[model samples]
Target: MASLSLWLFSGLVLLVGLERVAELIVSNRHASWAFSRGAVERGQGHYPVMVVLHSALLVGAVAEAWLTDRPFLPALGWTMLVIALGSQALRWWCILTLGNQWNTRVIVVPGLPLVRRGPYRFLPHPNYVAVVAEGLALPLVHTAWVTATVFTLANALLLTQRIRVENDALRELAVMS
Candidate 1:
């Protein structure tokens, strides 16, 4: 049971890493397309920090669980696993709905309108919501409470800046459109 839980937790982290890489690939393509038409990226100063923080988060979660020999509580672990999976679905839904407009960074194309379909219809930043859910749930899956707490706090700071930048960019684009 313990071995199985560890395997499940490890698999989850691996999938998340792969998903992030895939998102970056698509983001790069979208960024190029946006830039070709005069889109401007905001929050460049904080981008590197965001990348590092997220990378460290995954690494920390794995390390904390393995090094500390964290025991997975079935109730907590299974519940968190469900939340993590649900978040992944939400994240992908955001990506598909946004289509080519979705990018990791804030690249606002002039004269383009805000996306209001699918999940966006319900929340302005559903992707971030998914991020928050996964960040909290993933660490807790293996009882990595420190990792969960740390990542959630750090992510809150990062998201505050990111959402501010995104909203400002969108507001500017709205005027142009």
Candidate 2:
């Protein structure tokens, strides 16, 4: 049952990984389009590093799940899945809200006001909220609480810098607007 659970959660991780890849691809394309058309101020730093870190969460989660042989608890997995699914929805809502303004990279257009609509209207960092939720839920899906704890802590540390960079870029754009 534990190995079966490992396989199942690994599959779920793969599905989410594919979705993340698709998101990255689309974001790259859209960001390129926006940049070419003079829609953003490009703040190119360690974007690829962020991508790598994000992918590593899945790798870590899967490893922890399989190696630990975490027991199968339907309630835990189902609850985590629910949170994970909700975060995905909120993430897309963020993408839609930002429109062409959004990118995995920190590219803020000069003279354009920071998007204050959709998810942003309520939270200064809705996408980060989604990310934080995801960082927690994905590991919990497989009952890999260690992964959940470690990844969440690591992500929080990374986001500290990331969010500052994003905010600085957006603040510049907001001033111009």
Candidate 3:
């Protein structure tokens, strides 16, 4: 049962990492297209940190699980798994609604309107909300409480900076349409 849980957790980590990589490829293409049409990217300074932090999140979770010999509490693990699944669904919805506008980095196409579709209709930064939930749920799925807590704290700070930067950029350029 322990090994099965670990394998499942490992698979989850791999799938999430692959998804991020795939998104990055799509984002790079969209970014180029947006740039050709005059999109501007802001908040360049913390971009590397953001990448590193996110990468570390997956790696850390798996490492902590192995190093700490974490046990799978079926009740907690199953609950968290459900939450993580919901988060993934919400994240995908945000990406789909944003379409070509979605990128790992902050890039705003000049004169373009803010996206108010899907989850964004209710939340200003729905992607970040999904990320926060995933950060907590993914780690907790395997009893990696330390990873969960650290990721939540780090992501909170990162999101604060990211959201502020994005909002500032939107105010400077975009209108809700």
Candidate 2, superposed: residue stretches over 4 Å from native: 39-43, 175-177
lDDT tens string, model 3, 28-127? 9989988997898999998998898889889999999988889989999999999999998998898899998998889999899888878987999998
C-alpha RMSD by candidate, in order: 1.8, 1.9, 1.3
Which residue ranges in model 3 land beyond 4 Å of their true spot? none
lDDT digits (tens) for residues 1-177 of candidate 1: 346767778888988999899999999999999999899888898899989988887888888998788998999999998998899999999989998789899988888878899999999999999999999998999999999999999999999999999999889875433
Q: Sorted on TM-score, highest at the top, how do the candidates line up?
A: 3, 1, 2
lDDT, candidates in the order shown: 0.90, 0.84, 0.90
Q: Give the number of the best model, judged by TM-score.
A: 3
lDDT of 2: 0.84
TM-score of every prediction relative to native: 0.94, 0.91, 0.96
User: Whole-model lDDT, candidate 3?
Assistant: 0.90
Model 1 misplacement above 4 A: 175-177
